[model samples]
Target: MDFNMIAARGLVLLGCGKMGSAMLGGWLRQGLAPGAVWVLDPHPSDWLVAQGVHLNADLPARPAVVLIAVKPQMMGAALPTLAAMGGGDTLFITVAAGTTIATYERILGAATPVVRAMPNTPAAIGKGITAICGNAAAGAGDLDTAEGLLAVLGQVVRLEGEHQMDAVTALSGSGPGYVFHLIEALAAAGQAEGLPADMAMTLAKATVAGAGALAEVADEPPAKLRENVTSPGGTTQAGLKVLMDPDTGFAPLLRRAVKAAADRGRELGQ
Candidate 1:
């Protein structure tokens, strides 16, 4: 797909909150012009206003890509406004959780290309993983278009099917909270082991960050990397014994949490 084509076609970002602003920043960081983006927000930001980007309360034009970043609950109100703008050729890329492609088809018509994506809060820092899926109407170029738009924020992977979107939502979408809790747990453990509170927190944060970076860039499997660090009767092994216990450790808790999130996502789609 020619990603260069999307920039030439123009784009509209509906809603400009934290995630929206982050996506905009990522695009600008990747060299997309501020003029190529038309923003629609009820409350415009001072910085966005100063960038020469349009910030109207209503739809201004029919764009090649109409990114839906508003809260899912606002879909009913927003859809009509977008439809009125005549987004016939627009590829609808919705970041709102559980808003299925069927909903977009119902509101915008079946011919419109719709892509559903799950992007985590990490995208705010340009280190996110986005899962993308699209409908039958999406052509080869449409997938490229959606992927290119999402790639502006972070890594993009196309899901096998839209059903997997719920799982993606459960994993990467809600995964940041789980990682945050793990960092907190590690910090508390450090404090218990006699480290100063401030130092413990600093260590935990850096350790988590470094570990994540290693996992991302490493060619070895995570288990192998983990085993390489664990020595016979070492302190790390002793801690791992508790964390890796099958009946009561991290796995069961994380599995339950992901299931709960997936179930809630399914419910939200209905």
Candidate 2:
């Protein structure tokens, strides 16, 4: 797709923190016009300046899309700047976790088309999964606009209902931390098995990274894939047995953790 064409429409990113900067980098790397982006960050980074992007504390006139990437706590304070730009044609896409469309309506009026998204940290590499849900005021074209722009970051999935966003946040939004912890655990286990610290870390990191890559391209079910590498009387199976045993398996714990995160997401949205 021609990302440059889309970028020409003028997009304002309201934050330049990690996630926001990642999205900006992805768009620019994919041929987005530097002039089309206006980044609003109190403390602008050197990289942003090098790319010839506009970094200002003041909000500009209504752009086609005003992406709200501020922290949830700072989102309320950021709304007043958007007040001058909230109208029929303009769209507000928020990446702030837990804040709802109702929250946007409260500040920008009910008629403003607002889209809420839960994006993972992997977007820093343009390989993230972003789940988005827009308010009723957003028409088909508006939704398409939001989706197309976010697609620059990674895959885009539109939810049937906004309620599912809590679950999405719990899963993908917090999923990276869980995976990172698993990597740490695997490395620790390797070290416990008499391996050198550096070697164990490398093995754990490569193993997890390779597994993720394989799973992405695999046609078979994950369970079947797991079985494929596990021999009946092998070291792999021995490890699998420990992980698969129902009494103290990893599933139950992970399920509880995800549920807890989902619950917390709901509470935050409240």
Candidate 3:
């Protein structure tokens, strides 16, 4: 939460899309001077324009950090804009998926401190979890700085190595989508059981949201929490019988889903 260093040195944001704006909002709320931030976005939002930040302005020569929040497809076209500021103390932190540290080092200089982060879409609401890993050129101080900035979005976890990022991407990065799909399916099932469509959807949404909130604050593990709800031969047990089936249940299904996602991530990184 200490903004003295970042405030004094200035911070450059390469893109000001949803994720970028979310992080920016968090920073500003935490008392960061808007003048200290210089954002470079081709299509800046009206909200971004109204924030009083230096939008599309000339960046500082040695800014404290240059956060890349552009899409992975746009990275090749966007990164070179900040090439001049690379290979120095300015730490480069990228939330762009599938872009590797080696690619950044090759483009921005091997000496540039780079941190790769995978943050989910929930970051737009400051309720996401982000996993970060730094390249060899990045030092402890650089990681600390990156973690501090990203913490504004949500919880931040440090990875032991960059290789773990793929699994992290599969699990937490794409997890929100999986949960959304679960909500859709649950609502559909309820409708098939004679509930009205709108009522089913509302019930499904609240059920999932309440369960997730409980999981977040609960002291016991999720399995234990589930056990607390299931009776020997009650309706919850009947539902668990299908969901926890040995051959065709959530465990195997989710394993395959996560593996497919991780495989695709590895392929994209290649």
Candidate 4:
């Protein structure tokens, strides 16, 4: 929690979109000195300026951390200006999708230390979980620093290898959309079963939210939790039979969805 490094050299935030703002806000709330952060967005919001962070100003000779939160499509244009920032003690942490460590190293230099992270949309509220992977040039200290900074958003998990990043992108990065879709599907089904439209939507939303919260705190696995709720020959059991059907089940459907996402990620990286 010691922010001496941030205070001394400052942190560079390369983007100020929703995710970037959420992370920046969390950092400030968690004790990162506001004066020690720099905002690099081309069009700064009034709210961003009011936060007392340096905006589009000259940077220090060496920053403590440079977070690349710009869109992947913008990297080619943005990274050229950052070439001077590489090959030093500076740690370049990128959250841009499909921007590989090799891509960063090649743009910066072979000696540049880089950590790649995939954080989901939930990070906007500080409830998101992040998957982190670092290149060989990054040392233990570098990884620790990156993880600590990212923890401001939510949970942090370190991956053994960068190769697993695609899976991480598929599962956690795109997982929120899947959950949101489930809410929509459940709401629609509730309506189909004669529940009022608005009431069904409210129930669906609360149910999914409550269930996810419970799943997090439960000591038992989800399957066990399902069994705990089902009574023999009950309505829940009848529903389970159809939901757990091998050919049309949740597992196989989600497997196909995750695979589609992961494949697109690999293609983007290439």
Candidate 5:
């Protein structure tokens, strides 16, 4: 939350899409000066233009930080623009999935302090959790700076090493999509059991949301929470019987899913 260094030295943002806009909004709300921020985007949104930031203009010779939020496909073209700012004290933080620290070091210089982060879609609402890892050029203070900025979106965690990033990408990065699909499937099952379509969807959404909130605040682990909810001979137990089956349950299925996603992440990084 300390804006002393960044406010004086300035910060440059490479892309201003949904995730970028969300972070920019949080920063501005948390007292970061508008004049200290510069945004570069091919198609600037009306809201972005109204934010009073230096849009598509010249960048500061040495910014405190440069956040790269462009998609992976757009990164090749978008990154070179800031190559001039590399190989110095300026820190670069990237949220683009599948882009590795080595790639940035290759484009920028190896001396560039690059921090790679993976944040999910929930960041749009300030509820996402991001995992970050920095290259050798980034010092302890640099990691602290990156974590401080990223905390505006939600919780920020540090990886032991870059190798763990692929698993993190599989678990939390893509987990939101799996949760969304569960809502859809739950609603369909409710409809199959004779509930009205609208009512089924409403119930499904509320149940998932409520459970997640409970899990967040509860002291007990998730397994204990599940045990607390289901009585021995109740309908919940009957449902759990099918869902907990070792061969064909959520456990094995999700393992395969996460493995597939992690494998793909490794491939993309390569």
Candidate 6:
């Protein structure tokens, strides 16, 4: 999407940490006006200051958008300063997890247009996916604007309702941790089979990375890909027998794990 309009209008970012910096870098790369952006953070990065962004300065009388990239815990401190900006034409988008759209409305105003987003760890490297939901006050244009801004980070998926965000948080928000653990487990298993420690780790990391890249470009489903790799009685098939067990396989384990994460997200919302 053309970002010329977004670049022209002023934008205020509430944080300038890793994820926020990654997002800002992408926007600048995509033609956002450096002079039109303002960043607010207690500890501003040298890189951010070098990029020509207004750092810790008095905000514009009214920015076109206010993006909250602070931690969920820092919401109290960062949001109070911008509460007045809400309930107006200026849209508010947040990447803070476990903070619902209702909470922002309560702090800002019932009519505030708030968009809550959940982005994963991969966002730090521009490989993540984000799920977003806007409050009742948000319209098609508002959501479109939010998506355009977030598309810089990675793939963007819009949710049907705010409630679905919990499922999204469970799946992708915490998914990187699960994938990292899988890498560790694979390395440990390889070590048990007598592969050297460093070699096992290298193999585990490369295997997972390669597989994910393949899946991203593959034309067929994962099941089809798996079948193509498994010979009549090969090592891949032997591993599949253990991993595909209906009762004890990855399905049941991942189901419980994701449910727990979703439940925790709901609890945090309260």
Query: lDDT of all the models against the reference?
Result: 0.84, 0.85, 0.94, 0.91, 0.95, 0.90
lDDT of 6 at 126: 88
Write the number of the candidate with greater TM-score, choosing between 3 and 6: 3
In candidate 6, where is summed lDDT lowest over 10 consecutive residues?
1-10
In the range 73-169, model 6's lDDT, one tens digit per residue, is 9999888899888778889999998888888998899788888899998998889999988888999988999999898888999999998999999
Query: How good is model 1 by TM-score?
Result: 0.93
lDDT of 6 at 152: 84
| lDDT at residue 111 of model 5 (Cα atoms) | 99
Give the per-residue lDDT of model 1 (tens digit) for 31-82: 7787778888878888778867667744445678889999988888888877
How many backbone clashes does every candidate have?
0, 0, 0, 0, 0, 0
TM-score of each: 0.93, 0.93, 0.99, 0.98, 0.99, 0.97
Write model 3 residue lDDT over 1-270, tens digit each, in one string. Answer: 899999999999988888999999999999999999999999999999999999988889999999999988899999887898888888999999899999999889999999999999888888899999999889999999999999988999999999999999999999999999999999999999999999999999999999998999999999999999999899999998999998999999999999999999999989
lDDT for 204 in candidate 3 is 99
Task: Write out the backbone clash pairs for model 6.
Answer: none
lDDT, model 4, position 43:
80
Error of 2 at 225 (Å): 0.7
Q: For model 4, what is the alpha-carbon lDDT of residue 36? A: 94
Q: Per-residue lDDT for 22-133 in model 2, tens only?
A: 8888778778888888888888888878989877844456677889999888887888877867756778899988788888888888889998888998887888999998
Every candidate's CA RMSD: 1.9, 1.8, 0.7, 0.9, 0.7, 1.1
Stretches of candidate 4 exceeding 4 Å from the true structure: none
The lowest-lDDT stretch of 10 consecutive residues in candidate 1 is 53-62
Task: State in Å the error of residue 110, model 5.
Answer: 1.3
Q: Candidate 1 — which pairs collide? A: none
